[model samples]
Target: MTTSAELLAAYDRQLRTDAETPSALDVEQLGPLRLVTFDGGRGFITYAGLDGADAGTIAGWVAGALGYFRNNPAIRHIEWKSRGHDWAPGLHVALVGNGFEPEESESIMIGRAADLAVDVPLPVGVALRQVTEEEDVRAMSAMADGVFGDPVSTATADSLLRRLSHADGMELWVAECGAEIVSAGRLEPVTGTDFAGIWGGATLQAWRGRGIYRALTAARARSALAMGKTLIHSDSTPYSRPILERSGFVKVSTTTPYIWRAPA
Candidate 1:
């Protein structure tokens, strides 16, 4: 078994991809930060190590990055990726000082696709399918927002619409009970890489431990294997971490998302 540090490095490497789509394989350099763009209008800022930076320099970097994003209105939102292990002094404060709000930190989980492909039992009357219609996608996104306790935003649905326009290999899946969406997630098969990412795994609070999320994960893993992807990666929250661990995912690293929202 690899150590946690080694696992984290591997996870980061898998996530940092470079593809025209939402692939994490590519990294573009914009001044001191690496500019990573995904399928949606999502931008990511990452750096190797932030050592020897005093408050003034850190604040300057923050302001510069924000200014760049402000100039680029095409980019809807950005996430400043932070590593707790690197001990970047005052980095979080700098980000906050520049209109970036911190969101819940997650552990980077990686595992073999085969390990997660086992048959998972789902609750009765539950079924999973890929959503392609605009109305169905919008309804699914709204239900997912409600399940995750987030305000229903057209942002997610709009992003999905754009993704549908491209109609690449990205897929969105959900578990439905009767006429309602109980659980939802996405499967991303990254071209030019051996990894596929499972994202937005959320289940309602009332249906916590009935294995719906795991079942949905397995269904996606099966799709990934069918697509010839060997590795799986996800930034998992505490709510879904233990279930992922049980399904053979290892805690490789942790990710803290610092977001820059439009001025209120």
Candidate 2:
């Protein structure tokens, strides 16, 4: 039996670097932090467990990470992705004291691909499929943004399109009801690892409880299994965590994203 500690250990070892920054154009290292510059002026800050760093050392890293990104004029939006199980107890104060606002925390869900690959009955009139065309990709992004209450992001769609063009093992799946996308998610197979992640899962309010999202998850899991991935991972919101939990996924940890936006 795989324990939560072991699962989190694998995640911290295998997923904290390249697996976390697939779209990064440049990455700067500040102490233990990886300050990443992605396309479209987005910056991201993350790291593996802080190890044994004390509050003062952790505080210095926080300040240095901010300065590293703010110096780049193209960096308009920054996010510090913090894990719940890390030993950096002073991260919250250091980040908030430095003007970063914390977003809602999400559970770090980990499970076996076979557990979630089992058949899940979809609702009548709903069909799931992988999308690659520009029109379909754009529509899926729009529906997911609306479901998550975020402004529609064309940059996200563009990134996905670029990945598809590169033949990157990233799959976007959507559940459609009469030509309208009601639920959507992404499956990314990490090269050289046993893990493939299901990310950005969302469902329309009216479509909730109809099994569309669960069916979409199973479809993604089946796709992951076909890609030779035996493990599944996700950072899922509360709305989606229960569904994943029901399918035998366990919460290995939690993650909270603290965000900073440049002033107009």
Candidate 2 global CA lDDT score: 0.90
lDDT of 2 by residue, 1-264 (tens): 389999998898889978888767998888778889987888999987687899999999999888888899998899999988888968899999888999999999999999998788988888999999999999999998898788999988887888889887899999999999999999999988889999988889998998888889999999999999999999998888999899889999999999999998
Please give, for residues 132-171, the per-residue lDDT of candidate 1 as tens digits. 8988888889988998788998988988877777766888
Each candidate: how many clashes? 6, 0
Off by over 4 Å in 1: 1-6, 19-28, 36-43, 47-57, 73-76
Candidate 2 Cα outliers beyond 4 Å, as residue runs: none
- The stretch of ten residues in a row with the least summed lDDT in candidate 1 is 17-26
**Candidates' C-alpha lDDT:** 0.79, 0.90
